[model samples]
Target: MSEAKSPQSTVDVNTMTAIGAPRYGDGSVLRTEVVVRPNPRPDEILVRVRAASVCQGDAHLLTGMPYLLRLGFGLRRPKDPIIGHDLAGEVVAVGCEVTGFRPGDAVFGSVNSGAFAEYACVSAQRLAIAPTGLPLEEAAALPDSGMTALQGLRDVGQLTAGQSVLVNGASGGVGTAAIQLAKALGAEVTAVCSTRHIETMRSLGADHVIDYTTDDFTASDRRYDVLLDLIGNRSLRHCRRVLAPKGSFVSSAGAPGGDWAGPIVWMGKIVLANLFVGQQIGILLMRPRRTDLEFLAGLTAAGKLRPLIEKRYPLAQAGAAVQHVLDGHAQGKTLLVV
Candidate 1:
């Protein structure tokens, strides 16, 4: 791997735009001249993005889809100039207070912003060691998608053994991971996806599969103890119909703008709704934490959970990767092999 650009190739955020093409707006794609902050804050560490993966949220922000997320990411453009957050790489430098990681340690994690460049500054708290057994390209898949699954199902859904959980959009990014995680947590996982993807979802351990093309999952009399909705296609009423009286509904954001008025909007609505009933409905933010990554590493290291990567691209093709995620309909996560 190339050494982190010495303080030499490095320039202020205004001086550079790497080879990646940054999405400019509704009909624009720029040369991606990016701003690279020269130094880290007291709690930050600079990571060289060895590999990065695209998430649906990244694509939404890139394309200004759903329209409303513009409020949170940016009204007209993205807040982060470079749009890749699920990253894995070696740390080149650490801030004055960073202790968990040091120069040369291999790490993987997500950042609130910035991951597409050769180097990026991340809060020390957001990173965790990458899995020792996995290659950097593969480990890059964990922090964002894996942790989202772990948090959304285990933490947000409060998934437990014997509960029947339905994962909508089960063939997409977070959906793929949730199926594995729900099964690990002992839930009888039900994966809801288009007909083309039922076999794939079933291969991931979904106890039952619902093909959205042929039938409406909400119309079925079969109810669930937990509903993990990755796509917002189903209405609250639709979810409520199949929700057992004491069951809860956990929403994993997809598309954007409309499904969320920013993440806080959905979160607030769920919190408020939870007050009136035994069922729980709320948005989930799956942060990449050390413990969560480590737990997932244990699972990967053992072979219980597999990252079903759809395709891998070289770094120069990063835009195509983003576009692929935007187009949707992949069997699993799409990665950039940097």
Candidate 2:
């Protein structure tokens, strides 16, 4: 982490550049715009964003898929025009109630919808000190995927040492993080990806790597204690078949479906099926917490968690960066260098 000069001495700036989604649409609808620089609230801090990573959620926000999300985000247009959430940067200014952070301290965390900007205001409760020696861009990748993986396996799945977990769609951002976090928790990890990502999963400390292109992992006789599904393309029957008698099924997303309902339709099936099965079935929508960010930082400092970054793009090309993730072409995390 680099402790450098602060961008603002006294919150004097009035405007900054940001990627704006004026209306809900695809990545093509995103454009660069000069927006007002946000001032920190009483419980927020202003970050001079050095780097931010593109996530699948950003794509959803762009297109407003799963029309259900619009109820909260917006009915017709996004409540916020700016895009992105995961960010890493230096603290230039703090709110009146903020503590433990000072100007020039390297920090990383998820913001609501303004991380793609040159500056963003983040709630103090959502920010954490960046791990020692980790690059801001790499640390930038940790907040969203890392927290989802940690909460899904440790909190939702109740994974423990000597147990086993099989991760489907094991080459994307969340999948890669789950593979390493599961190992750190002492659970055996079987990563399921296509032929190209088999080696990527193994390099992330997965105990077993299933090539989904050449074989059907669900057909195997072996069973696992937990099934972490990042891609919800497989039917529930196929998913439950690989779990142990008391195993748990957790999904963060599903295959692209109708634009109006999207993956939520699939997620709803998991909830409806949970009542009839002996195996626990649930969907994970991570609730980000400061404590979880601290835990992930500790793991990074101890070398137990290392975010795998596959590509870097300039802030000007954020649209393409987001499209890459939406298209499911990125093998790991995709970062935007501001």
Candidate 3:
């Protein structure tokens, strides 16, 4: 860890291109514009973003779906219009208080927001060295989805080696990571996806692949110790049928429910259902940590985990990228090559 300071980097460039939404609506609201590049605070680092990924959360911010998000995000419009969070980039400068990194380090991490630009200021605590063997584009795909999978399975779900774990909606960003992480945790992994993604799930080390297009996984007699639900398409009773008596059900995402509350309503339903059920049902709100980022990096370096990238877009096409994710049929992560 080096504590070195570079010159005030923001002096050279005042503006940079970014994808921003002036007001909330849909991906159509995202516009590529020349915005002021941010300066790193004393505890932050200025990164020249190489790649950033589109997440479902970005869609929520764009559309203001599940209206509850508007509470922290703005009552009428987003407080911060620039979108995106996960990124992999080169450290261009570091604030005086950021001791662990310096200029030119290859880093990957999550930020509060504003990663849809070529340059982003991120807290020192949120980033880690990019894995040596992976490309920056792939590393950019790791933070949010990877961390969500890890916390949902190992932390909230309390999954352990030899336990039977099933990942529903196993072909999207978080779903792909969940399948691999469950295997890395030594659980017997079953992945549920549409017919097209069945082979992809199997290649990711799933012990079984259920085609949701052809059969209802919940209708089967098989039981699992943990059910990681990335899609909330199934009812509580339907999902419960697949879980063991003492199993855990962890949800990281679900359908937007309606125009106002979105997944918050689904999360509330899950919480209320837990009180009377034998299985532990909970929703995963991922808290990103430097150590967890390092852990995922180690897994990637060791070939125990690999981020699956489904598509790439340029900064100009951010709207399409976001729309692709919101459509919810992507096979894996989607990246914006900044």
Q: What's each prediction's TM-score?
A: 0.85, 0.94, 0.94
User: Residue pairs in steric clash, candidate 1?
Assistant: 13-35, 13-36, 17-33, 17-34, 69-257
Candidate 3 segments exceeding 4 Å error: 1-12
- Candidate 1, number of clashes: 5
Instruction: Go through the candidates in order and give the clash count of each.
Output: 5, 0, 4
Q: Write the per-residue lDDT of candidate 2 for residues 68-157, one digit (tens) a residue.
A: 889989888888888899999999999999999999999999998899889999999889999986887789999999999999999999
Candidate 1 lands at a TM-score of 0.85
Query: Model 2, stretches more than 4 Å misplaced?
Result: 1-12, 255-257
RMSD of each: 4.9, 4.6, 5.8
lDDT of each: 0.75, 0.88, 0.88
What is the per-residue lDDT of model 1 for residues 1-338, given as tens digits with 9 covering 90 to 100? Answer: 11122122445544433433244442135233445444678898888778888877667677665556666677656666666778889998899988878888998888776676667788887888877678877887777788888888788778788889988888987888889988888889889889888888888998899898998999999989889888777667778889998887887763333543544555566677778777777678766677887898788777778788989976556666777776668779988765
Where's the lowest-lDDT run of ten residues in candidate 3? 1-10
Tens digits of per-residue lDDT for model 3 on 1-338? 11112112234377888877788886777777777889999999999999999887887678876677888998898888888999999999999998988799999999999999889999988999999899987899999999999999999999999999999989998999999899999999999999899899999999999998889999999999999998888888899998999999988876557877677778788889988988899889998889999999999999999999989987778888888888779889999998
Q: Which stretches of candidate 1 lie over 4 Å from their true place?
A: 1-23, 26-38, 65-68, 254-272
What C-alpha root-mean-square deviation, in Å, does candidate 3 show against the real structure?
5.8
> Which is superior by TM-score, 1 or 3?
3
